[model samples]
Structure formats: C-alpha cells, structure tokens
Target: MLGDSAYKLALETKRTQAHLPMYNEALVHHLCRETRHIMGELETLLQSLETIRDEPDADTRSVAAQLAVKHATVKRNKRCLLAYQAQRLRFLQNVFWQVGGVPEEIKPQLSPAELDFFSGYALAVNTYKAPFIDLDLTVSDLPPKDLYIEVRVLQDCGEVQLENGSLLLSKNSQHHVKRTDVDHLVSRGLLQHIDG
Candidate 1:
C-alpha cells in the first residue's frame, strides 16, 4: 500500500505508447503527498534511532528496518515520477517534429510546463531553420517523383502564398498544388494528401 501510487503511475505511463494520455494531475499530486508523508515517517524513525543508539536492543533493529523500507519507498516514488515525465517529454518532442507544431487537440491534454516546453522547442526549431527559407527541413528526405500533388482541404486555411501565386483553401475543396507548397499544411492536419 505504501508504494501503490508509484505503481499506478508506472502503469499509466506504460499504457501511453502511441498517443499521449491526459495529464494525471490527481495521481501525481497524490504520489507527491505520499512521498512527503513517508519522508516525515523516515525522519521520525531516524530521531528515534538516534535516541536509542546506545541501547542496542531489538527495538533499535526494528526501527532501523523500518527506516530502510521508507528510504526505498521514497527512491521508488522519485524514480517513477521522473520516468513518467521523461516519457511524456519525449513523446511531445516527437509530436512537434512530426506535426510541425502541437495540434489543438493534443494541447488540452498537456500540462502547463509541457506546453511551455513545446513552445520553446518549436521556437528553437524555427530559429534553426531560419536561414534555409527555401528548404523545408521538416519534410521527408527522399526525393519526390512529382513536382505537384493533389490535396483536399480539411479546414479553411484562407489564402496561402506560393512562389508563383496564392491559393484560397476552403473546407472540402480540392486543389492541385506543388507538394512542397502544401507539405506544411498536410503536417498541420489542415489538408489531406491524395494520390493522383
């Protein structure tokens, strides 16, 4: 029962393989409280052990064993918390690179700290790619077979400027545009690619 909260956090992390689950704020808070309580108990045990240091009795051994268990529990809880956060951060980073930015649907599920991290990461990536304005580093490395591709607008994107001209993307409207021109839109989920 002492480490049940940490175990639950581990299980929740394990369940999130492909997509991010909603932030478990309640469980995380509970685990933190549990760790604090255990730490207080550990401190009390330490003082008791010190008081009875010269006695060398069975009670001293019992208190020492309890202190060891409490210390182990604290370590386990800390590890679980760190692992869960690390996994979530890694997933967020992948989403940033794959989607070109964080989607609105995924934003609600992220914690405030995570949202800040995502924003900072996006800014860093944009800054890194600033010099190569003509090239899209986010697109696939393989060469395209065709210069242009067909895409259907899933949402209204207003007017998007291209090298030659601009196109008005309306909901449910289809267009034949250069693949490079709409690759960012496709990654953002505003347009869907169609094989022509």
Candidate 2:
C-alpha cells in the first residue's frame, strides 16, 4: 500500500492530467479526424461518377446508384437542413422577444423622406429636442386618472393631435393647446405632428 500522502498526490496527478490543455487539444484533433473521415465517405459518394457525360453510359448509372446509397446513409444522420432552419428561427425569436411581444426587425435602409420623417421622432425620444416638450413629464408610473388621455407624437411635415376621450395636453398647465395652434406649431417646423 502506498502512503496516504503519496496516494492522494497520485489521485490529484491523475485528475490534473485528465484536465490538461494537451488532452483537450488531442480530443479536438480526434474529433477533426472523425469528421474528416465521415466527410471523405460522403465525398466519395458525391464525386461525379461520370467525369464526362455522353450518350447513356455505365458511369452515369454508377453515379446515380452511389448517390442513392449516400442519400440513404445521410438519412440516418441527426436530421438535416430543416432541423437547422427550426433551430435558427428559434434563436432569432429568442433575441427579439419582448414583454409586448414580437416586433418586426427594422430594415437596413429607409427612403430619404421616411428618414426625414423619423428623424424628429427619434430626436424627441432619444434627446430633448425643441417641440419635443414633455408637458406632462412625471416620475409617477400612473396612468391618467382623468376620463381623457392624450399623448403627443411627432410626424413629418407637421405635428398632429394624439388624444382620446375628453382631455387634451395641459396647455401651459390649465387647458389644452387649440387644434389650430397645434397644427401651426407643427407647420412651423417647431413640432412634428403626433399620430394616434
């Protein structure tokens, strides 16, 4: 029997040896070799049997037979392209999913007019721009208790009224800004019209 310390050291050596980078590298090399072997078999089957096509030849028939065999062999693999498609869709859905549910991905390019239209809205939300006034800005996470609710959104060309029920935005505290005033503000390039 070895001494306890020596046995303990030996066990630790074995454990350490198993986890070495060299061991992992070897495993990676082994996997690469296996994959190459499998691909080689597939390549053999897929290689054109008819190096030159002519009127019906034995070579063409041989190639078709080889392909049929390979197809059967490939069926035994862990599914195929459709399986990959399913996995890909799942990944994209996971990334874009939010509490309000799925939103469409924005396209890479928008028309210049659309771009111009959106620039103000983007500036409003992202930065405190002119006419991007937060009339009812609050810290309280409460919905409007009053019967009416109004929100201002900027649009291209001019700003518009976004309201529902009774109340409009508290114009300088007491009343709502008049519809004409809102449109004028929008027309003057001071504000983009809000859409409902």
- In lDDT terms, how accurate is model 2? 0.38
lDDT of 1 at 86: 94
The Cα local distance difference test for each model comes to: 0.91, 0.38
lDDT of 2 by residue, 82-102 (tens): 343233334333322211122
Tens-digit lDDT track for model 1 on 152-190? 999999999987899999999999999999888887789
**Alpha carbon RMSD to native, model 2:** 19.1
Q: Which residue pairs of candidate 1 clash?
A: none
Angstrom error of the Cα, residue 44, model 2: value is: 2.8
The reply for model 1, stretches above 4 Å from the true place, is: 56-60, 141-150, 156-159, 167-177
* Highest-scoring model, lDDT: 1
Candidate 2 TM-score to native: 0.23
